[model samples]
Target: MKNIIIFGLFFLMVSCKSNPVTKLDNKTEVGLKGNWELTSVSYPNSSYIKINSFGIADSQCFETSSWRFISNNNQGEMALRKAGCPTFSSDITWYVNQEGNLVLKFVGADVKAKTVKEGYVLKVANLTENAFQLFDTVDVAGKTITLVYQFNRIK
Candidate 1:
């Protein structure tokens, strides 16, 4: 009877041991949980472009800065504050497309904002521990311009 009691106690103690929780393997949507930094940006079909300490400049015509990105419910938004001449703020609504691409919708901003008539689409070319790349396109008039914006994780 004592031996049986000892076995039962051992069994109970073992059963009471805490088990570690297992995380799900597939977490694509949850992948955008951390902070990211801008590394490189390219407007493939644009006439000319530049990336400086502030933000990005296009064709020596426009300059922008103070960028912020946020994502929730499979929808995302990227906002930027333009510096230099003709200052303004812009907010672009973004989402993950069915083809695992990122789509951007140009949402109107304040008084100094540049009203965009259309949108852009991008894809993740490379994702790493510290950096990633996004493939996109900017419509300069009626033309389809492709672009890739690379970013690094903010440590």
Candidate 2:
């Protein structure tokens, strides 16, 4: 009887283990569902810039430090308002690759990349809890390029 009870408790403990990735319900959309702030950005050759998001309205307007991330499986959009640019608004489609990485597609938003900045789209690969990297084929001159943008969770 004692052995059986111990085994049962162990089984229960093991069954309750939760992985951050699994907590995300594909049906409900996961990590992107809350408020996030940009922590650090890495440029070519390991250059670094530290930044904090400031805005008014939860991700609706950038004030001095804040950005809101609201997304779904079919589509997701970021509303950025910075001290310099208060009237910021953009929408993008969110998709999941077979590898379970979340990607933001510009063309997926039904707009031409050339019409925007980089030729029409972007992709994010290797996303993990509290941090992710950004890949964009768009640059200031409209050339194909990729860079990793790292982010941390706030609140």
Candidate 3:
């Protein structure tokens, strides 16, 4: 009878840990579903350091960019409308993972996201209804630099 109780307890413990709970912060995700503008892209230590933002455009190019996020399907679009910069738009798939990291994959011409290996992972920070920020760290000249993308929700 002791062995049977021990086996039952073991089975119960194993069953309880079978599936880990995942909290995706639905409130934050819902709050992000809307139109927003990239007001500023900044970093610490210096403001004139040259670097490309999102591997697609210069750090300055992302300023004043327009973005739209649809939470229902996790699809979005970002348009670059800055003067003298290349005018372009791209479809993107994004979601806030359990770790609070925003996973973004740009799509093109009916392309499958799983097949594409290129993507950007940015840590979400200071999320509010009106403003939020995405932080990315990159190595430049053997130093780790953090890039902050500040967004303001468009009313």
Clashes of each: 1, 15, 0
lDDT of 2 by residue, 43-144 (tens): 453334222222123221232333345655344445554555455455555544544455444332567534644322234545566655455333424443
The model with the greatest TM-score is 3
lDDT tens digits by residue: candidate 3, 1-155:
99999999999998888676555657677889999999998887546578887778787788999999998888899999999888878989888887888889888777987887999989999999899999999888899999999999999
User: What are the clashing pairs of model 1?
Assistant: 122-135
lDDT of 1 by residue, 126-146 (tens): 666666677655555677666
After superposing candidate 1 on the true structure, give the runs of residues whose Cα lies further than 4 Å from its correct spot: 1-26, 43-69, 74-88, 109-117, 137-146
Candidate numbers sorted by lDDT from highest down: 3, 1, 2
- Greater TM-score among 1 and 2 belongs to 1
Per-residue error (Å), model 2, residue 73 = 4.2
Query: By TM-score, is 2 or 3 better?
Result: 3
Each prediction's whole-model lDDT (CA): 0.51, 0.47, 0.88
Please provide the root mean square deviation of candidate 1 (C-alpha atoms, Å): 13.3
The weakest ten consecutive residues by lDDT in model 3 span 18-27
